[model samples]
Target: MSSLAYGSFCATCCNLIPPETEPLACSTCAKPCCWKCAREPAESVSLFNAPAVICVACDAAMDLRGGGKMVPKPPMEQGLQRCRMHPERFLNLFCLTCQVQICCDCFVVQQDHKRHTIDSIEEVYRQKLLETVEKFREIPKRLKLVDWEAVRQVEENLKIIQEMETRILGDIRQLFQQRTAIMLNKTAEKKAVLQKTKDFVDRTEMQHRQTLESIQGLNTNDFLRLQAALNERCESILKDVGQLQVEPVRWDDIDCDLLPSCKLQPISLNLPNGDAAKEKHVQIQLIDDCGIVWTTTFFIGGQSLALEMKPNRQLDEFHFKAIVEMSHSSQIKVSGKSFSFKGFLAKNELISLPKLNSGGYLTDTGDLVMRLGIRPENILEESDLLKALLVQQRKLNSQLKVENATLKDQNFILRGDMLRVSSESQQNKETLETQVVALTRRLKMFQHNSYVHNQTLQVRPQTPISPVSQPEDDKEKLSSDMQMLRTKLDEMKTSMKAMNPFAIGSFEIYRWSKDSKFYSPQVASHVGVTIYIIVQPNFACEKSSDVNAYVCWAKGPKLRCQIFIEVVNEFEDECVREDRVFDFSKGTSFTWKSVISHYNLFRSDGFLSDDHLKIKFGVRPAVE
Candidate 1:
């Protein structure tokens, strides 16, 4: 036996195989070979040459049928092959031209297949074998190049995807950090804003509590107004918070309903198991949102009371009186005035006690001995002295007012008399001037009469009976009347010369005794003697006199007189003056003013038990 060791052999253990066998065989075994063992077989070779090479047993089966080696098998013998005409048999061979395979029966009998060119099993098999070998040789190189290119492409795609994924992850991380920072900052800002909001709400609620307490003890229009204002502020705060852009986390805490509710109850110290005593001195504290507390006292009768207490502190049962006072320093006259109420906690109501008779006395001490259930008339009567004093003061003030009015009337009459006297003197002088003019005309007429008589005497050649012709009685009567008229005129002139005008000067003093009139006696004397003349060219002037002077007691020592007269009476209608004699002899002061139209200056001395003398002076015009 021989082996074919070169063609299509399994490339291992070739030395153990034999050559020159018709088919390759195993070198180590002496068995007939088919292609599986002959080409590179570990067996004996067979002695057959068939187109489709096979083992000896397989070749012999073909020879038993015919001498041809190209015998075909049934269609089913090949995988997925079936006879075309027979529905159950697969037609295996495919014809390229006719585009169909034929079974052995069809080749012999089918009319469609009889005229077509046919390919035998050996011819088709050989042609297919060469084509298959050519295709097989080119497929691996092309596949290898394609696989390498696919690997490169896959690597490039994976790298790009990896870079993009990294960038996306980095962006996501930075975005998360940025959002966190923003959220944290906003949270801090919101907390600060919320704190402020809480503070404001707290303050407003505190104000509401204070106002409510005030309304409890004292009910007034002012307190009511304050309460309304507080309510409005609370509402405004709530509305403002509602309009905020951010939703607050802890808004419920500031709700007024959730906050403390306080009511004023009579603190009864007389409860059982209690050494009952009224709260004699309690401190009233006013708290703000900032935790600052202001301490004040609520005084009732002579004792002080408190309004609020700490939350944790115990409230001892006690009954105390309280008086709340509020002041507004805006009214001009009534700023420091007080509104007082004497009240005690009776049952639950605040009962007001009767007012004391003593106006200035704060409380009735004797009323302490009188039981709460009883009213003491004796204490009420005991306070009568103070009440009577008040009444007496009122009466004395009325009398003093009446006396002052009487003095004012007397002064007015005196001033009226002066004005009348001055006006009468001026009228008298005008009348005298008119009378003088008439008297001159009358004298002229009398002289003419005498001249006419003398001329008649000269023309009648010395008539010698003048004693017999003249009426002596008529002449004597005329002379007597003239002498009386002249005497009356001389008396009028003397009276006009005696009437002098003067101005009043001013002086202010802090203290005025009962002998104030005596102290300034020289003032009155000067009023009668020294004349005060004001030279005012704008107005009608009586006489050009420079005796007007001023004296002010408040000036102390450096008192001097500077007189002025009108100069350049056009645009500059002002007075120019030089200092004259400064007189300080008249009780260290002296002043005068022209008594124009008989105007007199009068003084009012305001005297009271509570206050020192306050005086005022004025020169009033005559009523007439």
Candidate 2:
């Protein structure tokens, strides 16, 4: 009999085994075996592509599936445990008082736990198992809820940061635009003044060049003929040159920086151990640009929390106070520089911190952070000061414009006056030259006559010498005439000096308005007095109506004088005059009660033309 006829079998049993038996060859024992004597390989070794079957003796060396692998059982599932102190005995009882498992032998023998309460271990395990299952059932739902809330909070914080960044950028752009506009306006004003001065200088320069060319080329005979006209033109040019003088521009006039000195910045501080949420007392101090110190104290706790701020020094321009409500309230008042707000904070409602111009921020850790914002008071005051200066400068510029216009008018008048003086002087000079020529001819004739008379007296004794004595008398009269001419020339120079253009007083023309019941700010003036005229159509007087005029001597020599006020209508060639004697020692103002009646002064009578009245005043010594 062959080994194959016997089939696979257990060597020890020596009984015929089933042909389906999985046989394993033991590498260590060098023997063939069946599944009953062999085991599966561990998972670590079975992963590789190797023989599936493994014998028990070669289990550590070979790879197999679902064999030789041990599955650990939880200790709680174990039927019972031996006591720590009494290892030989099984712990069948649980001591409630000592909180330990005990063997029956130890519970009976140990003095410490002899009187403790005890229960069966199976009963205690049943109760603890139910509690653990219930706790495990709630874990998944609670974890999902926590995860959702964390993600939502993260998204909300990100959105807030984006909004703040966008808003701050927009504010910065707007601020820059405003500053740019201010600078542009200032530059435009400065340019206008400079342009006006340039135009005047150009015109004057052209006139001067023309005058110089006219004087440069001259013919002796032509010059003598046009001497009076030439002198008048030169005088007029000199008067214009004097009036065209303008002051140079100064640095102080246009010195203004429109940009803000300080910038807005974010500040933050962290409190230690959530102390801000508890009853914590915090005092914070802040200093401002004006060197003012502000202190704020926080009393946080319970249902009520108070926040108080006080300044080390009191301020007149700005007053500040703030109140924070942790609990629900209808309204709360918070003080600020320009405006005040009343509102409530619901739960954890977010609020943008107030921006203070000269104020500061108080932090939880008693640290004060000063946020530099636009100083409202300083800005307002500086704006006001600049506006005032601008207004004054504008007023001065307008006055300068008015004065320049007046000077131009005076220059024209002076030109006319100088032309008249030049004509007169030229006439005088020509007349003097003619007189000198005549006197030279007369003296030459007298010398010849005297010589003839002396020769006749010497040659013929009979001839009379009376003519010679007569010539001596005529010579004395010529000397007296020369003395008178010198005296007249001296008087003319004194008169020219007295006729100063600046010394002449001025007057202004004003129109009365019945609708507004106010004087027009647009005042018309002539050579330094204010002429307040009222057309009183409704005036009650013995006469039906009259023109009332008040004379205010604003600037002039203080002297007792009689002012002759005249209302002249040049087109109509009509005139009305009144004389008022005023003692300037008392006052420089005088009212001409009724200079003229409405009937006599109205346009119908040709006294007022084109709704215009010309007022003229002449000052003279009261004695005269």
Candidate 3:
């Protein structure tokens, strides 16, 4: 910290955990920083308003949405939830177009939900709460009158209903346990009245119990308001039970039938023989088209799956206990949400096994009828898909036509350039050959000169043996080496030009006939000299129809060094190599071409693309 901001700055504001404060680290770098400096721009909805850990540099440089790796996720907000459409933005606004809560970006940035009856999230929440409360008032209003004669007429039905009552009561008891935990903060006076009101209709039918369980998850404010209103009604009417009305018998009446037709059963864990002790930890994954994965997981035997419904991987996860439910006659289901319903039946849910034996839910052949299939709603389909596709097809056709015309014009221009290059290539080829011959002649001449000079020195015995130090041998030997390299370089250039009629530079051509020559992109050698391969059909050297590729230096200073070049085939096996030693020290011998034989890479499926050939090359330093 600078002197100006030292004392005022938080200890968590920088990288490094000082002994003076607790270690708070950035989510991205894992470096310790003060909360004040490292805090993210989004407002914190943490219990204590604790800021999210993210160094300023990472927050600015990170591109989580653009497919960057090691992405640090944003912390989940408490009251204000995030928008599915835009992960960075919060759902503070309502989207009237879809009658759903949406982030500010959804209304302002996304054009689809722009024009509609927009309102604040709080406003929508309150409106929905009131609507729910109005529906809730229906239960108590009807509870005032009971048709006792209708209920008593079906004594047999009453016995069956009473049997189901015990299990239903147990489920309701557990549901209220969760509810009580939520309602503990309310006033004792209101809670006492709520208890008295609950007692009047505590033994409700299964359907009503389901409705109550669903309502138990309402917001705290809405629940409190609902409870307060219920308390008011109970105080007004519970004073005299004798005033309640009793109606006549009507056995067929839907409201009088207090029993659910659907049978409720406990889930049985069926284990294979000799594997009865095995505990299964299963997670069912639901991946959307956008690549987001939602998993509902559970465990069997010794433990229950503790699935945490966290917004992302970074923050603290809100753990929930998973429940297994038989639900229906067929498929077994699992729900990871906090609220456990009477259970939902998985109708027409097919589990993707190769085959299912023709039997009941579980076949005798042990081929269970387990299938997982995508639901229709999960798939994203455009409403006007056909029209959109047709429009896109038309645009693509027009683009192709324009490209074809442009290519034709370019072909004319290229034809002229090709003719000019051909002429230069021929001239250049001849010049290189001439230079090679001249170099070879000079090398021979230098040998003759050296021999003649030695003979002259021998004949002149009077001539001193050079002041007792070194001879002029080193310089003469170096000159011969220089000429030798130049000769080899010229020879190599001639050979390359002989293999191609289209000049040394790059040129694209289309041919229905098979091609015999290919050039790889120039790659740098370990010595920094650019190296490239010139491939030609080998009919004699390797007795193969594939190829004889030669690696050669390209457009660089000729340095004296021996390099080991290994070439591999399509399967990446070392097919050939040029590891021969170059006697540059002898100043008499050297090699330029590093040739190897391999499979036909000119095939379209191999390295040769339709109009472009892509060959990956690895660079190795020249070893002296």
In model 3, state the lDDT of residue 173.
Answer: 83
Report the C-alpha lDDT of model 2 over 444-558, residue by residue, as the tens digit: 6656665665676466544274645554565566566656655655554444334322112323334433322222233333233333433343334332224655544444345
Which digits, one per residue and each the tens of the lDDT, describe model 1 over residues 425-479? 6687567667766765665665566566567656755337664445445455556
**Best of the candidates, lDDT:** 2
Residue-level lDDT of model 3, residues 321-420, one tens digit each, is 2222221123322211123211121211222122121223333433222222111111122223224446767999999999999999999889989988
Which of the predicted structures, 1 or 3, would earn the higher lDDT when compared with the native? Answer: 3
- Order the numbered candidates by lDDT, best leading: 2, 3, 1
Query: How good is model 1 by TM-score?
Result: 0.19
lDDT of each: 0.39, 0.50, 0.44
lDDT of 3: 0.44
Candidate 2: which stretches are off by over 4 Å? 1-79, 106-143, 216-624
| Local lDDT at 149 for model 3 | 49
TM-score of 2: 0.27
Global CA lDDT of candidate 2, please? 0.50
Model 3 misses residue 500 by how many Å?
Answer: 28
